[model samples]
Target: MARPVTNAAFEALLKAAGYGNAHAAFARQLNHAGRGHGTWRYDAASVYWWLRGRRPAEHVQATMTDVIGRKLGRPVAAAELGFTIAQVPATISYPTSAGHAFGAAEQLWAMLAKQLTPASSETFQSDVALQAALAWRYDLPDETVSRSRRQPVTAGDIQSLYALADHFTNLDRRHGGGSPRARALMADFLVRQLAPMLHGTYTDAVGRELMRAAATLSGQFAFMSYDAGDHRIAQHHLTIALRLAKAADDRLYGAHLLANLATQAVYLGHAQEATRLAEAAIDGAGRVPAGVRARLYTTAASAYGRLGEGRACQSALAKAERALDRATPDAGPRWVNYFSPAHFAGTALKCLSDLHLYRRALRHAPDAITLAGQNARTRALHTALIATTHARAGDIDTACGWGRELARHVADVHSARVNHRVRELTAALTPHQAMPQVNELLLALAATPPPE
Candidate 1:
């Protein structure tokens, strides 16, 4: 009889145990586990679809479980490895203890690192969001106590982790999240490097800083996942990221995570939830720092615009602008350094564009492009937005001109949202689809693949 392979759960467990993309390693483990029985003959590629949520027979599940259990130095259950078709509990709520929060963060990291199919946005219960928000508002997690571990974590290790996160963020901004290699590279680092440190021994101070860094990177991962068109996966990461931020007592970063969650909510078409998250972000952030306050207000404006709440959107945008006026050097968390005058202008442009105030939005387009320095992806997105705004204004020539320019840079970054904007530009220009310029732009978009 042929050796049966179990399901995607097995693959996830294998990856979590560091067997991902290492066929030889997995083969060796499989051979060792099945040695007492008939030899199991298979190459790594044969199990590829197993990672895509397929399940194998019972014998296969048992064999794989043995291999994984032996490697993990404990007995493993088929259900634990994802062999069973049980519903995985959502870990979206805030935790009452630091340990619980960190554990949730670790599980979220594993799911992301393994690239598991995420729960659907429909599964995002509002009560979960409300519970998380209320918990964050009314209570803080207990302080992290010293943990017993094989290795003692140092401050230098924490700094290195922060530097690693910075490197990924820079790449994402310059190249785009759809880059062929960026997300996987970051995931590998999260699993192989940062995850270990989270389990290592650390002083309370070091642990706090480490959690903050982890939270920032997790949020970045969520955004990258979002840009790649994995909305549910992005939400899962953001929920866990917020928990980590809260556990660290990093109020500024927590607010930033909330804004990120709001942005995701807007993208998922949950306008009410988006507005709620954005408002909660602002209210929970007591004595907000200058840059972070602007970001939060800007996100609120975005949510409001999505809901066609022009008055509310403008009010939030005005507050964001006022917050910007009070900006000082590096006033917020280091992660929010990109929140600048240009960012404000770009966000305002989005709000106005959503509200059909194209002429007003167009006024800020030039500043957005000029000041979006070193961020090729942002430039591409803003350029596409400018093109769309022109299309909406009935200026086909200018729209197509910008669209043509955008086409040249489309292949440079890996962002689904950027591609979506270009597609929206195409739709906005549909009335003139018969035009040569319109046909040309359409062809350009056709050649662009969906983000991975």
Candidate 2:
């Protein structure tokens, strides 16, 4: 009864789609975004929260949607949500595993709509009702995976694998998450280099680490499929990522695997399942370091916010903050890297924003802006959020002025999310026709239709 969507049920849905996450082919889609590796890596934990439920500032939300849509095919609004409760199966995880989180796909889309520039009612993500947001992380491969490769994996193969992973990582990050060209390179590496390497002999530790890197990159490739709206293929990539996780024997990172699964669940509208996975991330995070733990809990709080459990959301938010506090500014894993105090504040402000705690959101806005000072994209994002809050509070002049500034600053950043947020702000200002500056801002937006 607690299960809003069954684990096996999603597997069946994925199976029916003619794609599974296990195939390495999905990684090939990353070329679609034409992004470099530097653009793909983010404050993964904060993005996790946004993926789960917290409503980030408008610009960030738009950028996220742009980035994801560039990878997935259809645009994903920041407001979209799909989470669960009682997520982890004691069968594979501990019996008492803390699973079960917040809302589902509806929340994700809603957050996205909130970030949109042209506000017609249809653009609102809140109107979207996600029914399959949560699903099982360990989706099965119906047919035989044909794991038998012709050659064996050797130490040299691992070096090559790391090099390939690093190469793509840099490429995707600089460009966007959906770098199909880079993804193809990885796919080739998988077929020729990795497949041969896996066959060669290596220690269990080496194999696990190698698989872990492969799994992570495969999931990154899944982003490309998702951008193309090829859920069939995207599902396949997610599956491969999970299997790689198991091969690696890193349960904590496996929890990260579940977190991604939870993201898909929310997109599918499986709130219950999404929540469950989020809770599992938190539970498994206990053994991780402070920064990593913060990442897990922050993601959990996002799920909690989606579930509409205000207290739970706040509690999780507090925990996330504490975890952030526990970490020295310099301490964090390179894989889930790029989180800082500023990043944490931006994330937490988003949680409050999702809860409609506008005052808190506004208060944190500047602090987030300050923290994001080093990041032009992020600073622009926070600036837009504060402007939106001002607009929401009926301060049109303040809103218009900030909106104009955002547009000006976005002049240099090539982020779709930034553009979307700036546009959405224009849409929101439409209601204030009487305000001259609002109209001016609108006219300016109308004149350009795209940032200079």
Candidate 3:
């Protein structure tokens, strides 16, 4: 019997078109939503409809066309897809390109604009897709030009590329990691120098590691942009990152990438798929170092928590904690440094909090708060946790007090997670909004806007 036309068959077609391998390409295509949302349980048939001009929720048009074009052996145009699909009313407002690639790219760019408020459930899937696309771009060997007439490798290029990554990395750390300007520059750099760098002259192992590092960094940029709500761009970047990581043959990064993808799926309510992705990551990265392996387990635990699998959640958390005990600070990658005691406390507490074990959540809050150090983002998160838990526990006064504290902290900075937490707590404290302290704090927060 003829083989069924599966995602695998579709992917094979993509490779024939000079794209990266299937998962890498699909991962790249999903990159339109940022890596986290890449494995989103897509409306496969609905995507076929998108080619007929119906706009589906954020990033669907781009993702569908990008993938469909590869699969169908034709130019799959978003304009030809579901632009009129009533179910996808969310992403219809923004413009699209005249055709597939351009329209997709335009949609990607529009998604990256931090200023654009999402229409509905779309969130920032576009940025992720865009970022994924770029991250995997270096894996496309034919795309890298090696003209004999090209100028000698310039010191300026190297300095610029590394500096750009470092600059955005720093800003994202302090400002909460999303930056379109950085995403654009990084995308351009990947298309330009990075692809060529992989092609130029490294040994097999060196090339693999070099591409691996680039992939990891690209995914970071993708995540930052995704956090900023540019789902289209962020997704694209992560897709690209995964593609490159696969090409680099770093099993750990690929699995790690899937862990993030699983987390996104859970957050977006795709519990079944999230569990699968998380499981894939943990199993795939089994050969990774103990420390890296721990991080993977932690990611899986969180996904399990989201799905209300309490036993699975606790088990994963235990593994994560054990990994933490075995870890040597100097052994892990610099990127994983943020996965420290404070981060552990925060994520583990969140798992507890999500499961509605409010007391357990509360117990960890103090640890999180204490270990959170001077990072304002960390502080704001812990404070929000305290405020919300208190509110949930009917401790009105304490909730209001913590709400007031968060109000002051968020006055000078903008973080969606922070903003979301503050909003949640603020809503929880609303019954006591008339209380003098709560009223005063709200007024104070409203009086000042940070310098843009």
Candidate 4:
């Protein structure tokens, strides 16, 4: 038998929020708030879906919270409005201190390693993300915890963990995050090598450093999970990473984590949320190096472009350029090292491309291609963008040329995100398949090996 609709919670919430007819109120609020992305049909009938326990999109949930909170003259959380925190796994709870955060992360990693927890299908939970962002913005859990351990920890062990984190990050960047085998290997290392170190004692200073390293590793795990299309698991890991970063008092890295979440928002097509998250990232990023600021600005620019805010996007791009100009070779940390001249150009190209400014995008493409260096995955992305611009401009020959160039690296780069661009290039050429070059491009893409 089908489960009956549960309207009690929503009905009560609506009553508390002072809405007489929720059907009309929801439609009016959503329209006024500009929550719909041209496709959301927010009308009286749509409210029925919520009453039936059918969840809306992440942005709608956020907008609903905002709208109701305004009417109630207070901050309204999603939980009070009947939205469960789906991003949090059953294995862990919110942590309050560095030691607590580290312990929770270790427990979760062990569960994942042992397959004690089932994989979740929930993708994006805006409420959870919002809570995390707010926590990161407001709470800097700097509580001092004694690092006395069963066995004394050494600097060598900490160095080793850092090296492992760096290695995995580079591997993910080069080969993409879709490899189950790679994820398993990293998890095993975390369980066997890093977990014990966290439990063993050290001084307060060393404990903070250890937490920071673990945060980096955890953030990488989260990103890999995201790249592999495991959004729920990614959210769990990301939450853990943010807490650990706060515990360690690493503001710059905390900003990076927010930017990572913002990137996921953009990828998931939540332009408004992406913009908000990116803004939060910038706000929390205090006194960072110019390179780091540039990177954050790049994220904001991407979000603005997605929203079709040309002026805002251009302003952000300008800020990124100025920041890049101010950056010195030895200025930023290793995490921000990837934001090189090529990276700067690539980000600007993407912003332009997202805004449908192909003329500007094409002008910037060659420089990005030239400086993309040995990063085949990045090169493939830049090449595909060039192909897309030509295709959009009705220049079939030029488009096919760039497509052929992109296909050369498509098979070599094991990144699904990059492959998405390749797919876009192929789609752009679909109408011209009668041309020999276009047909060849399609065949090449079709024959490319699946991500391992």
Cα lDDT of candidate 2 equals: 0.51
Off by over 4 Å in 3: 1-164, 178-203, 370-374, 444-451
Residues 218-337 of candidate 4: C-alpha lDDT, one tens digit per residue: 999998887777777777778788888887788899898988888887877877888898899999997889999999998999889888899999999999889989998778877888
lDDT tens digits by residue: candidate 3, 232-324: 444454555566566566666767676776666665666666677777677666566667767788888778888889999999989988988
Ranking of models by TM-score: 1, 4, 3, 2
| Poorest lDDT segment (10 consecutive residues) of candidate 3 | 92-101
Each prediction's RMSD over C-alphas, in Å, is 9.0, 15.4, 12.7, 16.9
Candidate 1 C-alpha lDDT tens digits along 1-452: 44355465566777777786685577567756765644344335334435544344344557778877877788888778664342335555656676565555545544444454533443455567667777766784646656555457788988887888888888888777665367766765675467556766778888888788888888888888777776666766777777778768887788888888788778767888989989999998988778888889999999999888999999999999999899887776777778878788888898898899989888888777775567888888888889999999888999999988888777777787887888799889888989987988888877875444
| Candidate 4 lowest-lDDT run of ten | 84-93
Cα deviation at 289, candidate 2, in Å, is 1.2
Q: Please provide, for model 2 over 239-332, each residue's C-alpha lDDT reduced to its tens digit, 9 standing for 90 to 100.
A: 4565565556555666665665555555455555567777766665457878877777776766666566779878877887897778865465
TM-score of 1: 0.78
Task: Please give the lDDT score for candidate 4.
Answer: 0.75
lDDT (CA) per prediction: 0.74, 0.51, 0.56, 0.75
Please, what's the RMSD in Å of model 2?
15.4
- Alpha-carbon deviation at 128 in model 2, angstroms: 20
Alpha-carbon error at 257 in model 1, in Å? 0.2
Please tell me which predicted candidate would have the highest TM-score against the true structure: 1
Candidate number with greatest lDDT = 4
